[model samples]
Target: MIGRRGFLKFFGSSIVGLMTLGGYAFGYEPVVRLSIARYQLTPPGWTPGLKLRIVALADFHACTPWMTADRIASICARANDLGGDIIVLLGDYTSGTDFVTGHVDHRVWAAELAALKAPLGVHAIVGNHDWWHDATAQKRGAGPTFSHKALADVGIPVYSNRSARLEKDGYGFWLAGVEDQLALRRSVRWKRQFTTGLDDLSGTLAQVNDVAPVILLAHEPDIFPTVPSRVSLTLSGHTHGGQVRVFGWSPYLPSRYGDRYVYGHIVEENRHIIVSGGLGCSVAPVRVGVPPEIVVIDLG
Candidate 1:
């Protein structure tokens, strides 16, 4: 039906089109940011005049070549760009089984990661992926896959069922973090046998100052339901904002909390919950409508 000239024209156009799309796909800036969440929480000691901005980075499944040390540097630079007084990483820093294969160099990555800095400081917590390995093989000071020491070495304190005290402008707050629900649930029997004490939110809360507003840095957003109202704000990352929301709806959110909280800010009773979409995709490398995110939250 088509002549030779028409066929050639069409073929050439198709090639050009494909090349254009390929360029975009493989471009150095292929990474797209989904959203920027902003919120204000007033700590109890509440001086109306003070303001502190905190940037949150989470779920960096860095196994794929796409998430390189350069990419992490970019994220840190962006956080600095956002005027963040402090930076927080919600975990899942590495992806795949590098510890088993011995193919991934975590120490090198840690050295590169140490470059990230914020005025107040960088804080972090472990995620499901970080702990989904054989713990018995770990060396002391080496957190699951060397996450604990690596992050600590980078000046980012890794909180695993622990608490830290922070002070800013004469105001202080207690930051408490707990193990991920999925990880805890999966390792219930092992915890009992080892007597290591399973994740106890109640015990973690006991460490906080009752009067000051407590900020919780939990890896999984699913833990919000069980969290008591005593907490002022909860920072989390795990859902990846459903990863692939279509028309504002995500079809494959595997979280127990489900579609109700694929991403963003949610207020519960007296608690403020912020679910960061995270920096990298999990299970698969492709991301559709839901792009990655770095949450910037302000506390006054």
Candidate 2:
């Protein structure tokens, strides 16, 4: 229905638009933008009149030209300024993608994270990449990954299938962290009996002997469906908002449930989970629509 000139004009415009989008995804969002995402919710079993501020940093995938030690230190400084009641690190500290020119040393990143300050203290959990990158753990088909050791050496408690008790004012609650849900790979040499995860959700929850409500920290959100109502809230990060979401949906979802457990606050059956978009890239170092975020959750 158009002439030659009109068709040429439309084609030129379309090419320019695609180029702009590609530039933003590859250069701008991943490299330059760091956002803060906040949520306020009162979990089902949360104590009345008790407010908690949780600042979370996740999926740093520390590598050159993206998440450098200086950048991590800067992020930590900003988190410290937030004065959060508790600070949590939701793992994947090692490089997620091999597109880096250099890998940031574990000690260097750990030291930068050491600067984080919180009244209830800083807590950490390991992600799939953390386990995958550990040569010793992968070879042996067991844990105590380098990521765990690094965080522990820096005074941050890396909760691998464990629970810790904490309080604010007169209110008390429990914090539990499970091991990575996708820790080991099923390989021929590894034997057919190799397990998928290092996680022991039941064992971790069994450690909670008291009546305090529990807040569970997981690096991946795929465990939400099975999370018991006994847990007041569950916090997670790892999907990175599907890394390159478009129009609130990602064509490439990393989880088994696809976009269902991809990102943001999801409430089901009176239970709650806050899945952070996180601060780094996975698979590849490109982002569109979903920018790197530092998640701040206000809970009661």
Supply every candidate's count of residue pairs whose N, Cα or C atoms clash at under 3 angstroms: 0, 0
TM-scores for all candidates: the values are 0.79, 0.95
Q: What is the C-alpha RMSD of each candidate to the true structure, in Å?
A: 5.1, 1.6
Q: After aligning candidate 1 to the native by TM-score, how far in Å is the CA of 44 from where it should be?
A: 7.8
User: In candidate 2, how many Å is residue 222 off?
Assistant: 1.0
lDDT of 2 by residue, 1-300 (tens): 999999999999999999999889877898778899999988888889889999999999998888889889888988888879999999899999989989999999999999999999999999999998887888898889889999999999999999998999898899999999999976676663664988899999999988888999999899999999999999999899888887787878889888888899999999899999988888888999899999999987
Model 1, residue 187: displacement in angstroms?
9.2
Best by TM-score: 2
Query: Residue by residue across 1-300, what tens digits does model 1's lDDT show?
Result: 999999999999999997775554433222544356677677444446657788888887665465666676677677677888778888887763242222235666566667667777878887776665426422231244467667777667777788777778777767788865555223454543331323568888888864666778888887888888777778888888877666888778867668766788887665678888887767756566656677888887
lDDT of 2: 0.90
- Scored by lDDT, the top model is 2
